[model samples]
Target: MSSLDILIFIAYGLVILLVGNFLHRSKEKENSSSNYFFASNSLPWYLIGTSIIAANISAEQFIGMSGSGYAIGLGIATYEWIAALILIVVAKYFLPILIKNEIYTMPQFMAYRYDNRIKTILAVFWIALFVLVNITSILYLGALTIKILLDIPLIWAIVGLAVFTLLYSVFNGLKAIASTDIIQVFFLVSGGLMTTYLALNATSDGNGIIEGFKIIANEAPEKLHMIIKSSDPNFTYLPGWRAIFGGIWIAGIYYFGANQYIIQKALGAKNLREAQRGMAFAGFLKVLIPLIVVVPGIAAFVLDAKIDTPDGAYPWLLNTFIPSGFKGFIFAALIAAIVSSLSAIINSTSTIFTMDIYKNFFHKTASEKQLVKTGRLSGVLAMIIAASVAPLLGRVEQAFQFIQEFTGMLSPGITAIFILGLFWKKTTSNAAFFGIIISLPASIFLKFVFPAMPFLDKMLCAFLFTSFFMVVWSLLEGRMKTYPKAINVDKRMFKTDRVFNMVSIGIFIMLLALYIVFW
Candidate 1:
């Protein structure tokens, strides 16, 4: 990179910090526990929407999923496109009940529906998953990307990203994080698209994206397919028949519905309507993600990118195609994705620890100010732990798939717990707890026992098996009666307005067309 590129990069850092600080100062209730964690229920649909995408699309998608695209083709896009439809389902069904119940965290919902034991246990589980898998891998991947792009040491890159996240995000809380996401999304998408355009354009020898895409179609058509056959080596990553009616549903619902880190964006909404609308907006954004993140990887493949590993596909594109001055803007976008996601994870981790563990267990009489302070401190600690562990992770091929599979380990029981706890009145606390404890073992058992089973199918099988156990346990405990603490959800609560319905239908149709064309 030239001196000009270095200057541009420095400028972006200053602007982001200034914008974040400005947003933090603008908030009157910044110190309130609710504001710190849930944005004081003051976020509009757009902020919630952009922030959700920003938090979700980090180095994982940019580097890992892009690499998956290079190797596996458009089939890898199911994770993004399927999420669009899942966001609709979550907005209509999950958010309504969660918002109505004033759910501060997913664990809090577990407690509200079942018992304090469920809440505390789930909270501990979430904190571990976020810190260990989510935060650590993100740091590892982002640092790895920085190492490749900027020629930096991986350890310093991880620490630098963590510190940058804490500087702007950990202190100001969700409000600032979500607010700054507007800028982050701009950089994230635009930078991502810039990479895509650069790769595609370069592939066609500077013709254009459309011309390059046509060339790609003529050259590597197999990369355009959305479905993989059993004979395909990558089929295990995205099993054959992976769709809404498949195991993708289980993963999608768990991610968009029960996941604390993602849902915390909607939980911070001004109202239920705003949250629902926000998810709809996020669904629309989800459709664009594979275009920005995945297409570039395919472009790299068509161009015969020289890289040692698949995950290096994106970074290789940057180092090869992106010129000097523009490097800063594109790298800034990468940082935007990394920092936004890291901050969201840290904040959510802090929220779970502060509300579910600290406030509930450590100090029942903790003041609001104290709660906020604890949250920030926990956020700092989580960053430290995640950064420390991130370096220990060795080379990961298809890090995106690794994350999904690991996260899916916990999803089966958690999904069953939330699904039954929401829709079924007979689901007792013990049944849910049983589901949680058996979740990891069930997935692990299936993994080794049925070694050939695809991870997604394994998730579905585990989820169904776990759900069966929960049902039997609940029914036997209830003696054909509803649990006492059953959630009192009305059918009307799931109803959506015309706009949200339109958004859902639009997303469904778009996904349908994409799958059909790409399939």
Candidate 2:
């Protein structure tokens, strides 16, 4: 890499540290859980939106997604597009209630909805998912990609990232982490766009987008097609349109709307309106992500440069397409994306552990200071665990798919309970409890024992079955029980601030037009 590139990367890191330090000062001086965990509900919509996106999309998209795209085609974009529509739902429905309830963590929302048992169960599951599946897997892939491109050891890279992420999150908490995420989001998007543009330009032909697509299309047809059924027997073959539309759609909604690490930014918003605006803004951004993440994958496939490995496409693009001077900047941005996601995971896990687990179980009367301290301590502990486990992520096939499949076992059921509980007051605590418990074991069995069932489709089935059980059980058991009054989620909770809302809607429309163009 050029000296200019190295300088730019160092400069980027300095800027992130400066912003993180600035945010650290702006945060409430008092070490309180409210500020540490929720950023004192002071985050504006834009900051929250950027932080949410930064934390949600990491090397998973940069490496796994690009790799999948290189391997699968534009079809891999189903994750982002489906999530865009889902975010709209989240903005309109979920954000309002979640903010109105004023819960610190998602599991806290569960406690309010059902009983403590359900809350504790969901919280524990989320912590496991965040630490072992989400954070560790993403870090593993991110570090591995960096190692491949830079000729470094994967273990050293993982440790370095873990140390940096833990350092800021441990002291500055979500406020510092989320604040840095705003800057990280910009770098991630810019670097992604640069890679896409350069990859398209680096083809044997010229730099026109359409011409590039055409050349690739004629050159490599397999990478462009979106049809890959389980019967295909090819190991790298992806889910088809049915899986995309049905399975991915449901999973996206659950993830963007309900997952702790993703939604914590929304939950930390200044108010319900800000939270809705933030989510809608994120929805808009989600629409644009596929352009940067998925299209490049398709580009590589069309180019057919003998880079057969999917995971290598991203690093390959950087080495081949990006200029030496700017490569450092792109690598720094990639690292920022990785660290931001790690911070988000660490902070959220700590929040859940301290609030939902510790406070609920052992220290019901814990002070905000005590809670914050515990959160920071937990953040340190969780980081160590996530870093240690990161190496194991290599064991999983299609790291992203593995994360989804296992998390899918729980997400659908949890989503059902939350959807029913939030809007439908008729859902009894018993129903919520039973719906979640039954879904996990059943989903695990179906997913492992019967892999041929189009895994996501099976998850949908499990969701439906468990939901049906909840409804049936509630009716049978709750008929005689006094019906609780309907929840009074205020309309203001769903409304967005006009400025952010207008800009967000405009972006969403633009994304829709692009989706249609690509489709």
TM for every model, in the order presented, reads: 0.97, 0.91
Give model 2 RMSD, 1 decimal. Answer: 2.9
Candidate lDDT scores, in order, read 0.89, 0.77
Candidate 1 structure, TM-score to reference: 0.97
Error of 2 at 480 (Å): 6.7
Best candidate, TM-score-wise?
A: 1
Worst 10 residues of 2 by lDDT: 229-238
Clashing pairs in 1: none
Cα lDDT tens digits for candidate 1, 267-353:
999999999999999999999999888998999999898888888889888889999888888999988998999989899999999
Runs off by more than 4 Å, candidate 2: 26-28, 204-210, 221-245, 395-404, 448-450, 480-486, 489-512
